[model samples]
Target: MKSWRTMSICLLTLFLTILMGCSFSQESGEATGSSIILEFSEIETITDAGVQLAYDDVHEVKKIDNSFMVYKKTASDSHLYLGSVRDKQLTEYGFVGEETYIQDFTKNEESLFGRPMTLITGICGANCVENYLFEQVDGQPQLILKLSGHVLVADLNEDGEKEVVMMQGSPQIEIHVYKRIGDQIMKVNLNEEIGLTNSVTYNSQTNVFEMIINNETKQYRYDTDSDSLISL
Candidate 1:
């Protein structure tokens, strides 16, 4: 009878040990899955040269973050450079491109692919502008998507995700819609051209996208399940 009692106690001890081991492993796995969140500072123009400039003839110095900066030249034929701040000086690390007449530099209020994005607007031609959407990957800015002409960024379907709507044309105004799906910004085919004369905007009061085409107002609602726009 004593032998049986001893054996039962041994089995109970072994079971408790296994249970504690599994609990420790589950907690460790949760810690490994955690990630770091990046925060960006307000967009500030570089007025003083306290921080050394990247270019001798700089048109503008746009501070994207505490570490990352953008420098543009003063000439008509100029390029944009992704820079870094160190020891009160700006150093060029990534070359954006030439003939990039930067008009606006700002951060998107909406997150893309569960991450923040930066939007850079540049002149493509007369009465034309291109929107360059960039995401930070491995500590470097990477262009994920580009939209031309009159563009609007909004949560069209109110699905907690924003979509890009662009009114493009000179010959004829055609509205184009783009969404970020699985790390790719794909054009959502409306299957028909929605012409616009003035501009496109998201009416938060009504929760719909509206535009004035041919001096008349038209509205559209984004269908999340169908992945298309519904005319209203």
Candidate 2:
């Protein structure tokens, strides 16, 4: 009878331990989920040109020096606005177009036309994306360049300037490179498309750009003279 009692007690203790562990795991998961939702969905307030702007469902908020860029989405459309705070005053600078399907807004690390730039991506179709590049100029945001497909920016030539690499994924994957010369942003003539690519990224260590396609990696360097990407 004593042995039976001991066995029952051991079984009950094991069951209780598992129950407590499960409860703790569930609570932890709930807390993490709530944190993420709050981080994105919480109501936020900002002063734009002395006008109070209260927004929720915030997609992204970026700070550039004394300026702030906020991207917010609604059930049907999305809005992006830039504002600056100086001398205890808030001033609105620019507003993006009424885009119905804005996907992402990001700031490039490099400057364009000797000014900071930001990119806004919008979805047009099942596999098509439009990228709008905006440069902060004279206390305002100016739309400088626009492209279709996936875009990545880097100083591909190490020339103290950033280049835009675009990969078009529909119909077939095509790679295009663009560089700013003087006041014009010109598309580099590769003569031939880089063929198929899953993604393109800059490798700072190698000072070149890397393209991945079907688990295969290829490296490329921009040729200033030829105006093309030389596969290495």
Best by lDDT: 1
Candidate 2 displacement at residue 48 in angstroms: 26
Note each model's CA RMSD in angstroms: 17.9, 21.4
Give residue 165's lDDT in candidate 2 (0 to 100). Answer: 68
Q: Could you tell me how far off, in angstroms, the CA of residue 227 lies in candidate 1 after the best superposition?
A: 1.9
Clashing pairs in 1: none
Per-residue lDDT tens digits for candidate 2, residues 111-175, read 75355677665555567666656676776555566566777666776767776767776544555
- Structure candidate 2, residue pairs in collision: 49-90
Q: After superposing candidate 2 on the true structure, give the runs of residues whose Cα lies further than 4 Å from its correct spot.
A: 1-109, 122-126, 189-220, 226-231
Worst 10 residues of 1 by lDDT: 31-40
Candidate 1 residue lDDT tens string, 1-232: 9999999999999999999999996654331222111121222233322344644445545666665666665545466655556565565444444454444544444475456887666554565665656677797555566565666776767778776767677654555667766655567423143322444555555767565544666666777665545667
lDDT of 2: 0.54
